[model samples]
Target chain A: MIVDLRRFLERRRPLWEELDRRLRAVEADPFARIGLDDIRRLHDLYEQVAADLADARELAVRTEVRDHLEALVARAYALVYALEETPARFRPLRWLAAELPQAVRRRARAGVTAAAAFGAGVLLGGAALLADPSARSHLMPFDHLQLHPAERVLAEERQMRAGGDLAGEQAGSFAAMLLVNNVRVSLLAAALGMTFGAGTLALLLYNGVVLGAVCVDFVVAGQTAFLAGWLLPHGSVEIPAILLGGQAGLVLASALLGDGDRRRRVDRLAAAGPDILSLLGGAAVLLVWAAGLEAFLSQYHEPILPYGLKIAIGLMQTAGLAAWLAFGGRWAGRPAP
Target chain B: MIHDGRWLEVETPEGVVFSLPLAGPVARFLAWQIDLAAIAAVATAIAYLTRWAWDLLPDTVAAVNYVAIFVVAAGYHMLLEWRWRGATIGKRALRLRVVDRRGLRLSPVQVVLRNLLRPVDQLPLFNLVGGVAMGLSRHAQRLGDLGANTVVVRVAPVPLPPVEHLTPPRYNSLRDRPHIEARLRRAVPPAAAVLAVRALLRRDEMDAAARVELFREMAAALRQWGALPPELTAGRSDEQIVRNVVDSYFRAPS
Candidate 1:
């Protein structure tokens, strides 16, 4: 049976328009402006639209008519059901200041475990590098090994290390690559936590060993001071950020582990939703800063800038970051009266 | 020919049913490609602009470019999804919108969670893992959407149909008595009312016996509520009486 859309629209348009207007008004000002009357009207209109949409389907109505009604009803449905405005946006800063620290504190056990595992890897790698020179080649990637040669490293260390004279295009690409790689590693660490956290642990171990091996390489090559000047500026923030990724992975693992027999594993993951978000969010924020430091200060040592000043700046940055994490959200998590 | 994916049926407290047409993998992939292209375009623009500015502070180029790329890659989705009601530019272009699976407003936490897991979804290379997960999932939701309890729905505007005008015989006897009208409206399922209208519109198509049986069944059901007044039913045929009652109920005020 053919349904006359034009005829049907002439009769129903007024009701649909009225409903649309009311919904628009309520959406615009959700507070004191919408009274009981508006709510009732919205509800009534939503029901009407829903019924109309169903009828349109059954009657084989015009596609345009069906599409228009479907969208209208969907909008009305969302507004009616989602009346409570969840103020979740415009407060990423708050998430960082309050929620992130609280999350780290709540999951301190996991964070500590991650840190310990990383530290163990570092120590093991450092010991191996010191004992056998071959371990240095094994631990460092080919590109990394290429970055600094033993002879060139020593030669550069003899003079105040002038930063590499990279062209604008080269520097831009380098920066992009660095940021992408760092964030990718961090996200990978966090995601690998889904493998019951063993993957996360392995990544942490690998990273720690590489870092430790590189440190030993610098020490053996007599570039400890240069390494400190380069790493400390960004390492102060970057390492913590990476650790946060580790913490995130551990949190995922914990969620899986913490699922007592009663709840589903997915439910446990859901329960740990905030912690996961906080860890990931915090890590991303830290990575942005680290990227900035590594790209700018670590790469560039102005001819006049002393190594002592760089070391001092790195130290200060590390201390400041530590203090912020320790006390960032001290009072925000308190129970409301 | 758009092959709409699976339908998710949601029944509201008011007994209204909504059948949401879920977006399929093909549409979602296209949307992702659009977003990816947009991000790349923005990154390229920044690369050129950064190159120009880097001559003055060459060492800071990496830092500046790093931030520029990061913001474009990650921040684009978050800001647009949150502010534009769960639609990225790609999603918007495809007429798709992300909505909470349970019909709640998409919260900030959910947005962040979904986007953060994006890299994970692109696991190993490309979005192979995500595509597989989406294909296997009930709602065609990728890992992030599943984790965040959200779904992307295709939203097409459905124009309202004109009301059916069956000129009443002077007075809608049913409408005259508000109590009985309200009771009948409440007791009758929306489907039944729609069926009644369809039956009236297409009576000629049905065989005489089938038509009689259909109205007899409907009239019997309508009377079971014991709200039909004698005046409205005195000598009216079962079909006419049922049609009048359904019409009056539809015309009732909010």
Candidate 2:
């Protein structure tokens, strides 16, 4: 049936083609205010012409009537789309676009809400892994790594801590690399997560799982409380930072799926303008932050700060992000580029 | 070259001017927050209700508790899609919807696909993988809607019917209703177009009743133009014909 409809339309292709040119001309005309009435008339006429086409085997083809119908439909559609798109030609976020703020605000609220719930789920998932010794094993494979390098890296890290060169540029350099690597990993976890949602889930799950497993691995390997002490220096901030980045990434995915304020919808990705940069920018910041934490602070270790202290910093970092977003009330009001 | 750099120019209901960029991380973040809070709250409640049911009934019957909770959760999701045509809590609070690519309601198959994929999309790692794909995809589809061939969009609680005034005067008479009723419907299609008609036509009735009568006429006018469903009521104030469809049907008196 659809093929037949196409063929029928094809028979009048010349007329519609002519009408299309004419319609395109009017489409940009400032006065073309296609309204619901126009669409109605066009739709009504379409049916009449379509019915006549169906009866072409019996009745003579009324090319003129078909042409008129085609023209009307094209005209109506053009007018409606034109009126809807024209104002946007000048200023972005025009007066009518002002509603976008409220809309965006509402969407932001929704994102926060989703983040909280997801966070809660993460906490619960964390608890679930902790409770199940076997499940904990699956999350962090490094936990059970009894490789000689584990001890070597552990010893090197310990030696670095005692060197007291913490104030040196080396420490800063180390921190930077750690931050960069960490951010990249988180981003990798997020960016490479483009493998459909499964990869993202795997990235997130494996991360949590690895944390759980590695934590258990450390504790079981006679690191005792010292094992706890080891991760505290950076894992606290690093882990949660990665988690936060993932939250942003996930939110992007869900919204990408369609949180439709026509102007703010995911369609904007392909839509032409500076807005696409802004859209990608939001995600970029997450990657950058994740990277910074991984590079600069992930390696911080002083007997002065225990696992508990580092963990506190991590928790604080996460909390700070929540507070910032809650108070910021517009995606952190980043300075315009 | 004709298009702007990034976002495509779009015409918002109030006529805002900006390229319509796809909802990104920031926008998505906000949308999820609003959606999950309600879903979690409801899911928790359903769990509690079923938990209570478990205690009241026999083990075999109590086993039904799990099924009961599932039903409520699934049913809530389904019914809202069926009725409001969006996620229940999100739709009511934020006035959004899940629509086909063409902005029509989802088919039953689409609904099932969206809901079924929920468990997967909600998997650990923040649906990170799913999100990137959604962002990159041409349709901006998440895993659920990707499977379902649907996308959730912010819907005006009442999407107004297209009312264009650019074309030549070519108004058609009504086919749904005949005689004086069709005439009245044509005269005041939006119900709010004429205050005098609303006030003077039936002055003494309750506001609701009078509004009902007003919309009935409007609905008839809408019928004349074309087969306009309630979807047109989106994002508009004068959407009574769509909002109170069953009542408007009776009120039309044609």
Candidate 3:
């Protein structure tokens, strides 16, 4: 116990001040490279100040003094014993080739679940359209989709033949709109995972219903080639990107449920956090590519860009994407046995 | 970790415990409002700065502007909180900080996840969902905070109480009776002693009559505990007696 508060403060004040100064310096520049000696010094100061806090809590000093020491110690502790890795310089190529695919493969079960949800919606939508044909209005919300697929295909081809620019000078703006809208939807799907995947599943199902209904509408109207040429270029990437978003949501939900895991809920969530981010980041990148293709290439019809060539391009992209995700990071860290 | 109403008491691996004050929903809401205004201000500034570009290549400028605004809106909190160690512009303004629930360093994924989940917390407008969640949560966590394993804390500075002003008189009657001084120190709890010292430090802020009554009650308590002789306390005022007792208790024995 402190017999003389003034004397104790006088003696310990310098160490506290030093710790405070060092903490401020570190906090001021998060990316600064601290030398080994400096890191050791910081650790030492933290222990000393933490000891002081314990002593102060023994009622040796006023509450304010104890509080000050506690604050100082807390700040130091966060820095000294941080659990997360230090921020490293980002390398996009390495991330694309390795981290992105690895993250997806880690949560393959969730991706399958997401695909199942979308597939169920597709089946239901297709069945409903085939049974009633009037459900198209409800399934397809867009005004353009309301047009008879064959008529729309004819109009699109005629416009191309007449040299009428479908997107014209507004292609850039349209691409930007698509990028913004798709990313927002993907993020929403991921965020709604907090509701135990209900909202996420519903969003995926709705998107699938629209896709299924539109495809059926075109095929029934003898516009299968037009549909494939128009959608495959962008949809190959964009659809998968949305499915990735759904995958992220399912991953978040599984983490929350912790079905068989024994770790605490927060720990599970923390563990899943990085993978979710990677999934979302990967989705955003794919959406960017999809948006550009959709706005510039997918809008054109047969006379401008042959359906066969477009189909070939789309098939090649799908094959490449499948191969990459399947084997992108398989040998990243294998030992030379 | 223990959540005792307003404070989160965290025990470190070394067995040292510290408490962090939790920020109330009202303060958090105000901080969010400030952040919204900041976003709006940035959007407006971008519009003005890009006005010249709008006239040059209207389509390209519009496209760039759309993407830029969307990025700013989406990235503002995530980027700032990541860089500032869980403080956005508004959080810094209000002296609030987002901290890991376990008092560890804030992680990048935590920052991204929390911001991404803001949309769910903001369901049906005006953060009704987040507000209700905060009110019901033991640690005042919204859905985003829960998902991220984070909590917002108040980091207001604690000013040291001025003990020097409670200097004992040259001829202190309490010091003359060292046994009674010892008794007072032993009887009085540390918290009570601190409260008495704090009262003296902020005596100027209290109302005149209230201050008098406060000191009277304090002095009576001290006297009862100290059991000083009548002659020793005969002519001393309540404030003076309280000050004398504190000084005697806190001062080192000569």
Output the number of the lDDT-best candidate: 3
For model 1, how does the per-residue alpha-carbon lDDT over B33-104 read when each residue is reduced to its tens digit?
999999999999998987876668765676667767877888899888877777887998897888888655
DockQ values of all predictions = 0.22, 0.01, 0.55
Interface RMSD of 1: 6.4
- Indicate the worst ten consecutive residues by lDDT in candidate 3 chain A: A328-337
**Residue B239 local lDDT, model 3:** 89
Q: What is the C-alpha lDDT of each candidate?
A: 0.74, 0.44, 0.86
Worst 10 residues of 1 chain A by lDDT: A160-169
Tens-digit lDDT string for candidate 1 (A95-182): 7777778788888988998898889888888888888976556788657565554664555444435444543336555655776788
Residue-level lDDT of model 3, residues A181-266, one tens digit each, is 99999999899899889999999999988888888889889899999999999999998999999999999999999968899999
RMSD of 3: 3.1
DockQ of candidate 3 compared with the true complex: 0.55
Between candidates 1 and 2, the lDDT winner: 1
Assess candidate 2 and give its lDDT.
0.44
Using DockQ, rank the candidates from best to worst. 3, 1, 2
lDDT of 3: 0.86
Say which docking band candidate 1 falls in.
incorrect
Order of the predicted models by TM-score, top scorer first: 3, 1, 2
Native contact share for candidate 3: 0.69
Candidate 2 Cα misplacement greater than 4 A, ranges: A1-19, A22-137, A142-153, A158-207, A219-284, A299-316, A330-337, B1-100, B103-254
Error in Å for residue A124 of model 2: 7.5
